[model samples]
Target: MKVIKNIIFVAIVFLISIGLLVVGNGYDMYKDAISKIPLTEKVETIKEKENYTKIEEVPEIYIKAVISVEDHRFYKHNGIDIIAIGRATINDIKAMSFVEGGSTITQQLSKNIYFTQEKKITRKIAEVFMSLEIEKNYNKDEILELYLNTSYFGEGCYTVKEASRKYFGKEPKKMTDYEAIMLAGIPNAPSVYSLTKNPELAKQRQKQVINKMIEYKYLTQSEADKILEQ
Candidate 1:
């Protein structure tokens, strides 16, 4: 029993040490990135893009769909979703790899503007720090708009407006329910879900988005069916 207690204590301390080291590294990376380009200036630059789409300019359904699939608890969380992080942690532990990232829209926005797409613990931590900064400086709707404007939608489309025009030859606000839902899912894995490249996979991903919407009560089963039928 004494030996077992000692082992557990050591393990706990080791884990705490590793956690501190990771967070320290991430803070350094965050400072470096922010020094190069301040958050406010970076966000203003994105919002100034000719193709930047406002939250009101986008379809309500599309916004709901994105919230449902990307981060259902987006409105509830400040900058990070503890529930999502806990679930992702469990999954990653089981898989023994960083397979699932429970990134909130704010965190994704932080990465989009400040950090690389690299999947390192330090980068992830930096994203968390940046996410908090974003939440502090902007409203949730503003953060969502920034995320949409910066997300890559594949086929060289980097903004929601560009993706809408490229995919359906329409503006985001003019998108139909079906088109809106389809567009909402593409950014998850844009390369795989790009309609021009893999129509089947795009449809499959669209179904996933629809399912999430229904699950989140953004749409009923009938509504989802109608969208799919269209």
Candidate 2:
């Protein structure tokens, strides 16, 4: 019984040590990752294509559009949305696969800034921790802007403005409803829903976004129907 108690005490200490290390050293490790592989470089190198501009330089409308569609409660939530996480958990359980990710925009930014593309449990935990840190340190608008500027969209575009130019040959501020929906849809599965490569799938995803917008009251049903018809 004494040996078992000793073992338990040792285990608790070990766990506490790991937690402290993660809290103190983990942030530096992740920040180094961001500085080393800045989003611009990652997009340029990975896609072997266009240069990316910083998020601050991008238009506000594009950022608003993205947040409106991708994460409606982006500004309201801290780092994670409990409702979204619960829904994702249920969906994952039903699918019996990693089919759903409940990551808020902050979480997505955390993963993008700190980790690689690998989908492992450790990476996910780090992402969650970093996301919470980001929420504590930054404002909602800042997080949203960063995500919009750094996130990858299909066809090698880095920022929303770049994507707008690549896809519609216009600035993001000038994007029409359909154009906005199309751009919003590509982030989920860039290669599969690329407008240049898979117009049909892109259209389907665009419709889905339009539906979501309507549901969220960003667009009226009539407006959604009109966009869908087009």
Candidate 3:
């Protein structure tokens, strides 16, 4: 019994040590990234793009679709969503891999602007830190706008305006309900859902987006049906 207790204690300590090391490295990476390019400067560069579209320029349906599909609790959470993290953690454990990420919109924006796409614990932590910083400095609308502008929508479209013109040849504000929802779903897996590359897959993802919108109460079933009819 004594030996078993000792082994358990050692294991707990070892795990705690590893956790600390990971957190420390992540914090360092966050600091280094900010040092190279201040967050404000990075944001300015993006906003200064001639094609940048403000939140007001986007359709309400598109906004709702994105919030429903990407982060339903976007308006309620701070920079992080604890419930989402817990759910993702369980899913990741079950899969025995980093298969599910619970990144909030703010966190995704942070990663889009500052970090690489590679999935690593340290980078994930750094992204969290950056998210907190962004939340401190920007309002919800600003963050959402920035996220839309930075997100890739396949076909080499880097901003929402670019994607809108590339896919539909119309401004975002003029997008039909169906078009808005379809565009909202593209960012989830742009490479696979790019309308030109995979029209069928894009339609499937649009259905997923509409389902999420209904689940989140952003759209009624009838409204979704109407959108589909279009």
Number of the predicted model whose lDDT against the real structure is largest = 3
Strongest candidate by TM-score = 3
RMSD of each: 1.1, 5.4, 0.6
Between candidates 1 and 3, which one is better according to TM-score? 3
Q: What is the lDDT of residue 189 in candidate 3?
A: 88
lDDT of 1 by residue, 1-230 (tens): 99999999999999999999999999999988988999888988998898989889999999999999999999899999999999999999999999999999999988888888988999999999989988999998988989999999998888999999999998889999999999989988999898998999999999999999989899999988888999
| Shift in Å, residue 164, candidate 1 | 0.7
lDDT per residue (tens digit) for residues 22-77 in model 3: 99999999999999999999999999998999999999999999999999999999
| lDDT (C-alpha) at residue 133 in model 2 | 74
After superposing candidate 1, which stretches have Cα over 4 Å from the reference?
none
For model 2, how does the per-residue alpha-carbon lDDT over 1-230 read when each residue is reduced to its tens digit? 99999999999999998877766565565566657775455534534434444555555434545666677788788888889888988998899887878888888887766677676545666677778877887788667766766678877676787888898898776777667777877887889898899999988887777767767777788867786676
Report the error of model 3 at residue 63, Å. 0.4
Worst 10 contiguous positions by lDDT, candidate 1 = 110-119
TM-score of each: 0.96, 0.74, 0.99
Give the Å shift of residue 115 in candidate 1: 1.0
In model 2, pairs of residues that clash are none
lDDT (C-alpha) at residue 200 in model 3: 97
For model 1, how many clashes? 0
